[model samples]
Target: KRILYIMIALCLTSFVANYSMSSGAIASEKKDGEKVKKTTAKDPICGMEVQKDKSTKVEHNGKNYYFCSERCEETFKKEPSKYERKTKKGNEISDLSKE
Candidate 1:
């Protein structure tokens, strides 16, 4: 009778552990294939909207700059002052070379 009780307890413990682990795996797997949209900000280098959390960001002159891609980030790193204008509303990025 004592051995029967011990067997039942072990079986219940194994079942509980398996259920918890399987549920956790399913929850994580659901997000593994999903792409979440991040909070939006302006890409200073291109004057386009960017996802601040997802996009690459560079900090210069005590300010943060977001970029759409690594290329834009490299361009800004090369010349910080070139794209220092405000990028909001009707403000457009003027090619510094043209001006």
Candidate 2:
């Protein structure tokens, strides 16, 4: 039937559009040919996954950390060692409700 054909065409179009969007989001290249992906880091203060480019950055002990908000960043700044220890032990701070 025509309706069935139309539905199939709609599904295919949706599939193609979604595929393009997701692939583009996951990876891209810089002008210098460096591959860039949507890299995410767990916020040491709030346990949120933050995009590195968008989040607040802090460097301590030669490592970089990201935060979801200014409050989280301030918290980490006050006691970098505490979070650094947690990170080293693979303890991710979950439970955003605490914030």
Evaluate model 1: give its TM-score: 0.46
lDDT of 1: 0.55
Per-model C-alpha lDDT, please?
Answer: 0.55, 0.58
lDDT of 2: 0.58
TM for every model, in the order presented, reads: 0.46, 0.51
The true-versus-predicted C-alpha distance at residue 58 of model 1, in Å, is: 0.4
lDDT of 1 by residue, 1-99 (tens): 975455445434543544444423222233556843334455555555444545577877667787656666676899997777644654754332210
Worst 10 residues of 1 by lDDT: 21-30
Off by over 4 Å in 1: 1-38, 86-99
